[model samples]
Each structure stands twice: as C-alpha cells, then as structure tokens.
Target: MNDSEKISILSKLISFKSVNGHEKAIAEYLQELLNKYGIESEIVPVSDDRADLVAEIGSGTPVLAVSGHMDVVDVELANWKTDPFTMTEIDGKLYGRGSTDMKSGLAALVIALIELKQSNTPINGTIRLLATAGEEVGQAGAELLQKKGYMENVDTLLIGEPSGYRAVYANKGELDITIKSKGKAAHSSMPALGNNAVQHLINVLNKIQASIKGYMDIKNDVLGGTVFNIDVINGGTQPNAIPGSAEAVLNIRTIPEFDNKKIIDLIQSEIDQYNNSTNGNISMEIGMEIIAIIGNVNSKIIDLIKTIAQPYMSKIKYTPEQIKVAEKQSELTGMPFSTTEIKTMGVSGGTDASKFLIDQPNNANYVVFGPGENNAHQDNEYVTKEMYFDFIEIYKKIFVEFFK
Candidate 1:
C-alpha cells in the first residue's frame, strides 16, 4: 500500500473516539475492513459498549497473533492545535489521540494484512490479528479474551504497543496500595481532646518509605529498578475540627524479582512497627492490590523475537542478562513480585501483552511492538508518517516470515 493510502486509513481510524472501554464503533469498523479482505473476523464483545475484534487469515499450528489495543486514553480537545480525535498532518507528523500510542500500529497491521492477502502468501501457520479494547482501563478486554479461551491455541503473541521499532519482551508489573488510618475526632479548640488520624497516617507513611529503601534498588538492567509514588491521598472533610480519617494511595511499579505479596508484607510490617512505636490512640488499615504485568523473560520467546528482529537488532545499554539477574535477586530477597517468563526490551510501560502472555494457555512467544511516544499519556500525542509506514513494513515482514 502507498503512503497516501496508509495516511487515509489512519485518518479515518483517528476520527473515531474509541476511548478505552468505549471501543465498539472502531471494533466494528475494523471488522468490516477485515471482512472486505476476506479475512474471517469476529467481534468478541466484552460488554455492551466494549468489544475486541479477532481476525484470522490462515489456520494451522504455531499461530502468530498480531495484536493492538482498540482504545485511546482520554484526551482534552482544548489543548490540541487540531481536534484530538481528528487526524492532522502537519509537516511530517500525524497528530491524533491514538496516532502514535497505537492507532498507527493498528493501521500498519491492517495494511500488512491487506498486502499479505494480495500477494497470495503461502504459510504453514495461522496469522491472527487481535484488536482488543479497554487496555487503558484495566486490560479488561484482554482479560475477557483470555477468559473466553482465545489465547489457548496461539503459539506466539505480539502486542502493538509503541516500542520505537524495538522488540519489548518484558514489562514491569504494578501494585496499587491504599493505606488508611483512623482516629477519634473532637473540637480543635482542645488540643488534647481528641486524636488526629492524619498525623498518624503521615507517620506510618514516612516509616514505610524509610523501611522500603532496600526494595527500591536499581539493580535490574532491563527493568532498571522498583519505583513507588503516592499518587493520590484523601481523608479530611474540613479544616476546623481534628480529622478522624486519612489515607494515601500508592502506585508501585515492581521489577520481576520482587513478589507483590512480599512487598505488601513489608508495608504491613512497617505499619505495625509504626503503630507499636507510637503510644497515640490511632488505628491503621492497609489494603494492597497487585497488578502483575509482563516481566521476566521466557527463553523460547526471546529466541523467537530475536530471530524476527535479527536484521534490526543493535547493541543497547540494558541486556536481558541484567534483567534476569534483577528478577532472580528480587525473588531470592523475598519481596512481593510477579515475573513474566518472556522478556521484552525497550519497554517502560504496561500493555495487554502482559495478560495475553501470562494468562494464555500455551507458553506463547510474545513481544510488544508499535509506534508512539515514551510518555504516551502526556499531551500533544503525535506520530510521524515515516514511523507509521516503517511499522507497516515491519509488520509485513514479520507476518510473512512467521507464517512461512
């Protein structure tokens, strides 16, 4: 397909507001396009408004799955020079909500499939394109697909998440921890009349931060290190009386080495120590929730990805060995962690590839590749025309090679 044709298709895709869970319209659009190409496609509706489209071009063992999320993160239209949902070509860049973050990847996949069909390529294995929804929410679409047994027969899965033309074999898992503290409330006039939950909550948080220093080590090469941030906090009603409750929500990104449960335990221990150290009448409760994404490296999958990107592979600062070392150390150190058997490089964020690879039945060789910015959730989201077309060529090459 020509660049003009690719751009036209991409523009149409960007026009649709397939934001996160609301992906039905775009899914149907893709289903129609795939059908026109004689590809057998199905819309697997996760809910009434959200759905995932799966299209297969061939049938056989060792199926190759080219996947992309069908949703974009919410965008504020006022901040953009052009409509965030309207595809705009300025200079060489195509600006839109999902342009780089992955509508481009989806377009590339579609073009590649079209080209492959026109070429009458013969293959031994099946080629499946899974355009999933709700990746920006909680991976709900991927979770649903996995629940429905879509991942059962696939031999390899490729998630089209922006990785700058590099293969991402692993991604860091995440855990969100919410800590709440309670205390008796009374009039502010009498300082000794009542307890302050906010103060106790602050003390507990400081202690936990100090105690978890060991967990934040930057020893992993690929994943680098474990990071945590108090993203949100709330508890007080007004400024007058003593506050009776306080809470903080932490966003924890863990390396493959640390167990998520162990991290929770560490937090609990720190909170317990704080409660014991303070004689104040304060009670604390900690709730920990783990979101394990794709991390660690599966040898088989790594080998396959390397083969696919052999011509484009180059030396990078972080090697797979370093990531493996970090993973091992985290596991050995007894920290709350989740590990992926497959390793994907050049990735700093999470993707549905995590769910597809981890929860899938067969040990599929999986990697996340796409076009987009590093800080995807940031403003002025844009992707270059060259980048978009380059991804199309890559997808075409991989598709032909994998099927052959």
Candidate 2:
C-alpha cells in the first residue's frame, strides 16, 4: 500500500471522534474497513458505546498482537490549530486528536495488515489486530479482554502508543488512591466548637508526602523511581461553614517492586502515627483502588524490537520539514533527536502494555512503539507524515519477519 492510501485510512479513523467511552462507532467502522479487504473482525462490546475490534490474519500458537486503542482523549476544540476530529495534513504533519496519541499508529497497523493479506505472505503464526477502547481512561477494554480469556494464548504484544521512534520497554505502574478525612461540623462563628475537615485533609496529605519522600521511597533501574501527585482535593460546603468531610485523590506511579499492599501499608502506618500523635477529631479512610499494574524491562519483545529498529537507526534521514519540527521540539525539551532514528527508552506513565504483561508470565513480551511525539493529552497534537509512513513500513517488516 502506498502512503496516500495509508493517510486516507488514518484520516477516516480520525474523523470518528471516538473519544474515551465512545468507541463503538469507530469499532464498527474498522470492522467495515476490514470487511472490504475480506478480513473478518469481532467487535467485543465493552459498553453501550465502547467496544474492541479483534481480527486475525493467520493461524497458530505464537501470536503477535498489534494493539492500539480506538479511543482518544477529549479535545479542547478552541485550543487546537485545526479541527481536532478532522485529520488535517499541513506542512508534512497530520494534525488531529488521536493522530499522534494513537490513531496514526492504528492506521499504520491496519494498512500493514491489509497489505500483508494482499501479498499472501506465508506465516507460521497469527497476527492479531486488537483495537481496544478506554485506554485514555484506564485500559478497561484490555482488562476486559484478559478477563474473557482473549489473550490466553498470545505470545507477544505490541502497543502502538505514540513514542516517536523509540521502543518503550518499561512503564511504571500506577495506583490511584483516594483518602477521605472525617470531622464534626459546627458553626463557623465559633472556631473552637467546629472541627474543620479540610485542615485534617491537609495534615494527612502533608504526612503522606513526607512518607513518600522518605521511608516509602523505592527505585528501579529501568523505570526510575516511584512518585505520587495529589491531583484532586475536595472538601467543604461553603466558605463560611465548617467542613465535615474532605477527600484527596492521589496518583502514584510505582516501580515493579512496589506492590499495592506495600504502598497501602506505608500509608496506613503514616495514618496510624498521625492519629496517635494528634488528639483531634480527625480520621482518614482509603477509597477504591483504581489502577494497579506492573511492566517488564527484559522481555523477548524488547529484543525483537531492537533487531528490527537497529537497522533503521543510523540509516534513515529526515526531511527538512521533519528536521525543523524535531528541532523545535528538541529545543523545547532540551533533548536533541536530530540524529536519532530509533532508540530504546522507558516511560514514566502507564499503558495497556501493563495489562497484557502483568499476570501472563509465559506470554508477557510487551513493547510500546509508534510514530508520533509524546503529545497525547496536549494541544495541537500531530504526527509527522514521513515517520507515520515509516512506522507502517517497519510494522510490515516486523510482521513478515516474526510471522515467517
């Protein structure tokens, strides 16, 4: 397939507006696209408006699943240079909501699969295309697929998350914890009679931060270190009234060694110490655990990616437009990528890769790769046209090499 055909497919995908929790339309569209090429796909319903599309092109035990999420994060239309849902090409870059974050990668994989089927390449193993939903939110579709045993026999997994040309071998696991502080509400006029829940919440948060910076700290060679951010803190009814209840939501990115239980124990210990020391009507409660996942650094997928990417590292040259864009980005980040074509790196955030690799030891070779900047939740998101096409070529080569 030529680059124009691939770009056309990408444009069609971006027009779907398959924002998280609303991917059924895109799933159905993909099914139709595959049907045109005589490939059958199954739409696994995740919700009323969310579903996953699974299509296979070969048969056997060692399955290579090309996975990408169909859903994109919500777009702030006013902030974008162009229509966020309409995939527009300007100055050799395709601009859209999912263009860089993933739709471009998904398009590349789909086009490669189409071309592979047309070529009638003989394969010893299956190449599964898994277009899932809810990745932007919490990887709900991938987790549901696992629960339904869809990935029981898959040998290797590839997530086309936007990482430019880099192969991401490891991503820190995430745990979202909500801490609630309780207190007795009284009249605001009498400061001595009322117990402020917001104050208690602040105290607990301060203690938690201290613990994270000290005893609760852990680090990994690949994933770096565990970190937490208090993103949300809600409390109090009115400014004049004493708040009775308050809550703070924290997102903790942890290494593989730091499990949920250990972190929970540390927080509990801190709470215990605080309660013992303070004789106030302050108490804290833990909320539901939203995300808990782990990733691997030395999987077979990493080696395979290295083999495929090494040849293109110093060989491929960038166009002037590509160089200009890369240079501007490099200047902004203080990291030059002018001479780097492909490299192995690590991500601090999480991805669906963790869901696929966490429990399945035998089939846990996972890698995140794609052809766009790390601009998922940012404005003016775009994918370089040349690199986008390059990803298609690389994936095609990977399919031919691995499946053969």
What residue pairs clash in candidate 2, if any at all?
A: none
The residue ranges of model 1 lying beyond 4 angstroms of the native Cα positions read 76-78, 182-187, 191-195, 271-346, 359-364
Model 2 lDDT tens row, 209-295: 987778444665565677778999899988678988888888887765675567888887877887777744444444433333333
Prediction 1 global C-alpha lDDT: 0.72
The local distance difference test score of each candidate is: 0.72, 0.77
Q: Among these predicted structures, which one has the highest lDDT?
A: 2
Q: Candidate 2, which segments miss by more than 4 Å at Cα?
A: 184-187, 272-304, 310-338, 361-363
- How high is the lDDT of residue 51 in model 1? 88
Give each model's clash number. Answer: 23, 0
TM-score of 2: 0.87
lDDT of 1 at 324: 77
